[model samples]
Target: MELDKMDENEWRYHGEGNKSLVVSHVQLSIVLRLLKYPAEDSENPPQTVEQAFRQVQNIVDFSSNVMSCLLGEKFVHSGEVVKLPLEFVRQLSIKVQHQRPAWRCDKVMDIYSGCALCLPNLTSPTLHQPTHTPTLCIEIKPKCGFLPYSKHVSQDIKTKVCRFCMHQHYKVAMGTWKRRSRYCPLDLFSGNRQRMHFAIRQLIDEPQNNLKIFKGGRCIFSSMDGIEDSMDLNSLLHHLRPYFQYGNNRINSHMTSKALLTDFIQVVVNALLSAGGGDGGVGTDRRGEGRSFCEASLFNKERSRHGSQGSPSDSVLYRVRQTQMLDTLDIEGLYPLYRRVEQHLQDFPKERTRLQMDGPYNEAFLEKLHKCPSEDDGSLEYAVSKVHQYRVAMTAKDSQIMVALVPSCEEEEDDEGLPGQRQHRDFLSSRPPAFSYSVSILDLDPKPFDNIPRQLRLDQNIVSCYLRSSCALP
Candidate 1:
């Protein structure tokens, strides 16, 4: 029985999103992601069993095949899907109830789900690190990095303000969020060193849902909303001292915790900057002199268009910006195209099969997706192809970045036998601590195609509220 079924007690709640619940295994370096549905409609849920199965399959395939192509394979993890015993899943859900956020309790676990995705515990230190070494993991959800360039966007504000910033007003008005977050996606995605550091600090100040910090696979700091006993900045800094301290420079009572906190933020900034390119060094540090989003947007545009030699095209920000360009039409224009494609599918039954989720996850289908319309040919196929690419690009825009840092052991660094082990240093402070780190993008789940209209409505609402309130930044 033990071999056939998982032990519920071995797993604890990790975190949850709108669609899923994750549980980390206590004894193993792996996690199980199970699907969830609204509890109110459990008796008659909107999604059928077949649809749910297809949804799960689409996530695995899209992450492994589609997103992995767009956002490099080294950064994305395509976990295997496995069947879990029904009783085990039910027991597991019950065990994790108390840990879930109060606001997220509207949705309950899908106990009927036989399958769950098994992914490597990203918060855990990798094999190269010693067992006792502490791992500090920071997860950042940098939403919608670029300002809309679509001519069809009727609102001029959309061109000036980013989606994340505008949505903050809407979120606040709706009482979903108590206040607007100061962290701007444009800053982090600016590819500017100082700006990125500023963005990280803003997230630390008011994390909301944008940032989460974990120590040794246990969450140390995140938003305090409905989450019990979460650590504040001071407590977080105290806990982080050991990682920032160097040889013989122990983080004793004499050492200022403020310095260690600043150094730690620099380490994260360096990891994010460097992870996009070749081994060791951070990417190009384009300085915006701490300009406003509108001002920085212009600078960023200039930098992206006429980037110097060795622009680090492989950098993660570059990849994201390129993908964001797919939505040049923006939702205002894309919605009409989506509707036309939907109408066309209704007219032609055979064409509907092409958009169905029943197809096997493979390269052939990906090739078909890749072969998009080169231009606006004003055909049904062109519209269909455009909408498809837009949805795929949305996944990239909403993805989360994980920066995992582990304190380097002297013996491990001295092992000259190992090739390609480029150690990164904290360049922000004098006598910086040396640490090994890795950056990865997670939550590459494919967005539903049907959300196009909903997004259009939300975009309109956000702009209207932000404008009506006269909250446009100078």
Candidate 2:
């Protein structure tokens, strides 16, 4: 008998006895990486399989402990399964599926087994009569792990809320709003005046969205329209101030409020332009009618008196930049970023009344102020190019990281140079020396090997016996 072939009990006992057989440290590290757990030096490391299993048990125990703490109830362990009292399993299952498919599978299997094995024992009925006992069977299959226990709860609570808040806070601190929003904290609310003031200073110090709008295809306005655009333009300017205030309130201050505001405004303007027309014109301009009206309206009797004698009669030339294609692309990119920013702003906390006052606001802060949409560049090609470049860089980085993480393979092969040399020598030596062609070998035709059908012969024997039986009966 093969020594490797062991009984179930023997295998189980052997596996239990060997502490190293339960889990490998490398496997544990892989699991941690898959789970995205932060690496800490103090964390226990697994060297053997048993140690690994113990570590897994510890994880399960911790999970159970957390559940107990949150639910205020001890988990009842029946056999192999530890029934979770809390309703977070469904949500946990979704997180696991997204982040740790393998760990989730193993964990679920362990829990199910624990539940089954931990059941309380009870006496059976008579031998002839069957005892009606509740049997809880947990099936462990590769595909079965995807089944979510609490689907309704998982779908109800939005998981992106916290992430949105964090991102919004970062943007607000960085003052990216100079290009993004319509109102600042000073204009919107009165509380935390100092905070907002300080934030504005920080935003002015680090203005990122200045060139971003030009890249985003904002249209530059003539000096005349620039004056008329001040009303709506100031609205966006005001909206960005609060984000600057909030961002400056943070400790690290990685982002400035103006940058966040700029990013946001770019999104809004792009959206407005997208919805109104491909050129970001609000529907006021229908075909050429609106343009004609604006031109005619601007060149009224009084304005015409100021013009030179007989300047093209009454026809007014409306100079609208041809940006239909560029506007479409800008809007497409702007909408997603806008939605993300909006979601983040919506989730931001409303606790702080006003921003704190920090450094003095100077020319730098004033310089950070972005020109309104009217002053934007005509094309968004630069922005599009930047986006594409960022995506390419990220893809390259991911590929490099994956390559580095994966193990390399090595294999041996025969020396082709030596084989080629041997072949060359044999050909050179045998060229004219082996010219003896044998007639006997040329006339030889090998016999074909016969393959008999064993099944056919057996059938023939059965047929003969059947015929003999049939004749005797007749």
Candidate 3:
């Protein structure tokens, strides 16, 4: 049985084509470079296999370096040497011998390069033997039962076909069976399917600690699909679990208050949608969001003074804290939601639309007045109201939401004595209020900010007032 028999003729042709040859050359060159060979020889002619291999290696090394610079520090692991299979070498030797009469050295090099690139993913542990053996080996005779005889259909051909083993006879003559079903020593005693299944089970049961193991490894006996799916899902859940817990935690951690968590989630969702243009670089999407989420949580430890009289003006910082929390908690949902929202916006009407308020306390509202449709039902109004409600709820529980928003000495204390418990001496030492302002939201026309800055300012002022008033209430 031949390898070509198993794969489609087109794929086999592609594997033997010029592109495959170039990739092979690049791969071979990379391997040679890894072995510390002097790849360039200005004085030497390029006829020899050794010289050609060296030249290819040099090109691959140069390409790898360029790619590394453009991408990052470790875009390509150039040092790793890939071993060629003895069977591949043998096949190349046969082709070289057959084509030697007509093909020039350069043509042969091209073929060699293509063969290298076309080599399937290597199985591990790679045969590390010093002798360069072909990855596959086969022996053939004209009289062999599996060999194609005549173009005409005849009774003698049937007898000859049956003489060879059932697998090889049917596959070689008809070209319709497991092509790799060779009469090799390995295949003779062992069933390939059983061996493959065992290998896959072992890999599944005992996966590699490092994910890089999958690179250039054999697919046979490896539950790569299953493992990859599980890993990705696990990663998604692991990053998102904390945000949900933080949002729901009754005794909130200083760095991840409920209000801040909600804000962080909103920012993350917005960032995923590429909405509200901002330098969201580190907090932009899944990968960036993860990094920013962790960093923000760490930074909030210092900013969330954790106790004492809250500072209301530190709302901006509080909002930042919320953005951080949201980025971490809803990262999983953010990507999916962003995709859904983008699709929704594309399909949603551009004409006049209505707003609907629903959900917890009927506080959530949809604001379709914006140029684009909202991705999620929660609009700016609902978001602001949610933040205000969260703040009020925390305050009512005797927790200082303002203190958690700002960095201050007084806010650092874990416990502030009850109203009647504080000594008169302590009261005397307290400083006077620095400044104050009320916050609320006001309705304004949905027009671009370019024409009416004053209107926008008023609208903003109204929104702040509304939020502050909502926070102030029972």
- Which candidate's lDDT is highest? 1
How much lDDT does candidate 3 score?
A: 0.24
Better of 1 and 2 by lDDT: 1
TM-score of each: 0.87, 0.14, 0.17
How would you encode candidate 3's per-residue C-alpha lDDT over 19-116 as one tens digit per residue?
11211221221111111111242234334555444434433442233222221221123232233444554354444333222211223223232223
Instruction: Estimate, for each residue in 170-273, the C-alpha lDDT of model 2 and write its tens digit.
Output: 34445534332212211101112232233233223332221111100111111111223322434434533332332243445444545555543332222111
Q: Model 1: which residue pairs collide?
A: none
Quantify all predictions' global Cα lDDT against the true fold.
0.72, 0.21, 0.24
What local lDDT score does residue 193 receive in model 2, on the 0 to 100 scale?
A: 24
Question: Counting only residues 3 or more apart in sequence or on different chains, how many pairs clash (N, Cα, C under 3 Å) in candidate 3?
Answer: 35
RMSD of each: 4.5, 39.0, 31.6
Error of 3 at 40 (Å): 27
Q: Sort all candidates by lDDT, best to worst.
A: 1, 3, 2
Q: Order the candidates by TM-score, highest first — what do you get?
A: 1, 3, 2
Residues 273-375 of candidate 1: C-alpha lDDT, one tens digit per residue: 6653344343443332232254323234454343322214556666666665667688998998988887886798687667643344467556656777777
Q: How does model 1 fare in lDDT?
A: 0.72
Q: Which residue runs does candidate 2 get wrong by more than 4 Å?
A: 1-54, 72-74, 78-130, 133-474
